[model samples]
Target: MTATLQPVLSADAMVRDAAGRAFDDLAADWFRSEATFPDDAARVRKRQALLNAVAALGFADALASPDAREAWVDAASILRAQARSAAPIDMALLLATGDRLASIAGDPSLYECAADAGLPGNAQAVLALALGRCLQICAALEAALDLSLQYVQDRRQFGRPLARFQAIQHSLAIAAEELAASTALTDLALACMVREGCASARLPGLLDAAALVLGHAIDVVYDASHQAHGAIGFTREYPLHRHSLNLLRWRDDLQRLRGGELRCAERLGDAALQAQGVWSAVTALMQPGDRHD
Candidate 1:
């Protein structure tokens, strides 16, 4: 038998393409109808299938790699794609962070003994959780924005389209800005995590950054989306409610998982103080080539 060589793709491109195709296929197979929502058995089976597909693509192993930067970037791509889908599966939490948790679960004592031992992995998990939630929230907010735009354009009041009203347009514009800002922050956090690596001493700073971005993004996006969507957004029949509820629920879960933003901020502050100054602490993690000025 002759051996065949497989072609390799860039990590980011490979993850982005595979994740998109997988999620699209999953949505087609499972999320096509409202019946999928109420059926617990179907949802679980579909979600499991989705996870298996992602694992087959090597996403789970990438997240556990010793090369933290590459792992974080790959995980982020997978998470963003999962978030873009209308499917109810929390693949980001389950596939990305869950894999890491399982890896360390065999030895609880090791984690409990050293104060600084599990900090790196915990920080990574926390950041992953935040990234996943941010992507999910962004997806929901964008969907809400689309729905609002379509509604205002089609809905008429007093012989004119609702979109013709300056108030409605202004509200939507504000919502769009919030979404853009949130997405930008999420991107920035991901970039930092990939650049510095999870085991870097600046991991706490990265956690602090993720905490701030996720916290503020969720708040702004939630309020703006709900306001733009109005009464119908809360209704179960409307697709907006699913995204909104998920965002609301995940935000709470993320906060509790990481001890909230205040604690994160305080930890960063302490680290800065210990290093004598915040700027010095930040620069300490910088490589010789990283400093431009």
Candidate 2:
């Protein structure tokens, strides 16, 4: 049977602008003081409120629509902005997996339903979480990069700006490259997920792609960010630790979810072997209506 093509959904300038403004305002009003919370309880309360606000903004409903790819993009942007501001909320799992689980709770044995339908729902959820985390990490890295650049330019050693040192510049450059690569991988994964007439068979491969990108990103980006910031990066007073630590924690958390990275790699290898060739396997994973460049 020939698969019907569905138009890819994208947020226009107005939608993007509105989402950006709303999330910025919400983050500023509620999460700006997250780092100053006296205890875990207070932090949890604030995080709940932030999640409520996100739901009210229609994020929960957006994930239910197959064509709501733009909603996913907006969700990622919101998470990224929140992380860059050091919001104490767990944006990655909350929006990515939480919303989907809530939506599917009415069905008892949803896993069986997913299997029968060839949906791979759990993998899709993980893929979404990974993509959201990637965007968040990218934003956090950008903020760290900005801070490091400012510090190196201002702090002088031997009557010269630290930014003039080749070593410092090289480290920052490497961090920048990792950040860019992570962002690009995120974009590619999203494209594959939203391809016109996306197929269930492609879901596992897409999930694997997201997992690999995020796994690599967390390590390289985290190290480079810290190296760029030097000793100050580790201090609690410095904002760099906020992003760096969260990225580290989230990577580990994701690794624990649903048999994690090792399982994802195994599934990818199995699919490739079943297809009989690596290149053919990848090509077969692409959506029927996807454009070739």
Candidate 3:
């Protein structure tokens, strides 16, 4: 046999694949159902179990990966998969070390670690945590959309499926558009982080824009999904409520984080004005070497 060379996967690809497999195992073993716990104690037990399972899956090793960018990519993948399950787990805190520094009284998801100037690399770690949370939100929105799409396609009214209606299509289309825009903004922010490190001066602006877009997306996705499923969506038996509730909680946490949503909007507006336009401002924020005047 002639000597044959097998292609070697890059480190990033290997990391992503390992994270995906770990999540798949978790979903199969732990998140097989969307059933609710009987009480707070039960819920706490399940949460603790989830943390143990995640730890067993070697996520900590992935988090400590040498390549910072690959480590984030792996974390994002794991968080996204966990969100899609609609399981009540604080994967963010488990995967994102900086989230442990959350100074918020009630909301652990809202981070304040980035502001601690005395801590080395705290800014980058906080930024990574925020980005990972964004991925989770996006994944939850995607699950809701997927459920709504399936419901409409199967539901019949009069003589045809609800999906045949233009109004339903329009609503779903708007939801998808919002989701896509939010995801794209987050991806752009992640790209900026990969190119310029999460501590880059340009990162905060991109993150602000991503957060602004994601806030709007959560609203649109929630309305459209519930509207599509009608009363059933609100029922505890239906799984849609799980993702919806998660989205709403995350939205509130983001709004309350740091200086709040209004401050983020104000900062973005100020940056736009400084750059003379919104498009130019966002474009400059994505550039690794751009020295904005």
Candidate 4:
């Protein structure tokens, strides 16, 4: 869109409406320019332009202090904007949300400070957690969208494109589950974040839990979408490559850090006690030199 993240909607408006418009405008510009990048340098320039715009909008400053609920809402707008604009920008914004949450985790003053400033700390925590989860899951949605678009354009098994097949419908149905699950969890987390509760203390734990589930669910969506798309789905020109790469990056980097398949399995069954115990042990075992691979 533009190089400044302006508040198109007034603060007097409901948060939902305000949040919706912020991203809608940027996304409009984003998708309009999708695939318009002529080269790698162009892509970098475009992403930098968007980041400067978002930062100018004061997007990342949400963590400047303990009381920043409005900033969080706006921060989310920047994220949605970058998600449609550029992959690296989107990944950076999403991962940054986690860093902000981690920053929240150690600040004990957040509760009273938030209350004094008309921001709800517990709810903010939930929103923060959901923000990170949503960003990570965006990789899955990207993968599904990429593969679905490519396959619908090119695969022909019978007398027509694979998109016309009943089996293709089944595949979409399965992949959509991942999309829906992540979206639903995000909504729940946001709701909890807005409501004041003791849940704040448990946010880090909740985030770890959601990260595990979303991480694994994304893989399912990626594999199924590619299968439905067939051989063309594997091609380099396939638009799926961009999204698939992002998914791979997220899975390998962020998801794996919290523990990937093993964490997912534990959360899938008897999550309450197992997650708590596992986090306790993992926290104890963590060292300065630890590495994922």
The digit string of per-residue lDDT tens for model 4 on 69-157 reads: 33554554445444433343233433444555422222212222323444333343333523443554563475466658576757676
TM-score of each: 0.62, 0.66, 0.71, 0.52
Q: List residue ranges in candidate 2 displaced over 4 A.
A: 1-17, 24-61, 88-126, 196-200, 286-293
Model 3: how far residue 30 lies from native, Å: 14
Backbone clashes in model 4, listed as residue pairs: 123-193
Model 3 misplaced stretches (Cα beyond 4 Å): 1-66, 88-121, 290-293
lDDT (Cα, 0-100) at 159 in candidate 4: 79
Using TM-score as the measure, the top candidate is 3
Mind giving the per-residue lDDT tens digits that candidate 1 earns over 1-293? 23565322133657776866765665565444434455444344344433333332234234534554556555665656665555553433444444554222211111222123243254555455555555556666676677778878877877998889888788778778877876665665555556554444454455465566666766766676666566877665677665665555555544544576788778777877998998876666333224111
Model 3 has an lDDT value of 0.65
For model 2, residues 207-243, the per-residue Cα lDDT tens digits are 5665666677667767766776678877757777667
Tens-digit lDDT string for candidate 3 (142-260): 99999999999999997999999999999999999999998787776656655555556877777777678899999999999999999999776888877887787566544544246
* C-alpha lDDT of candidate 2 relative to the true structure: 0.58
Candidate 1: stretches off by over 4 Å: 1-17, 23-61, 64-68, 71-74, 88-123, 268-293
Lowest summed lDDT across 10 adjacent residues in model 3 is found at 101-110
Local distance difference test, each candidate? 0.55, 0.58, 0.65, 0.49
Give every collision pair in model 3: none
Highest lDDT, which number? 3
lDDT ranking, best first: 3, 2, 1, 4
Candidate 2 at 124: error in angstroms? 4.5
lDDT for model 1: 0.55
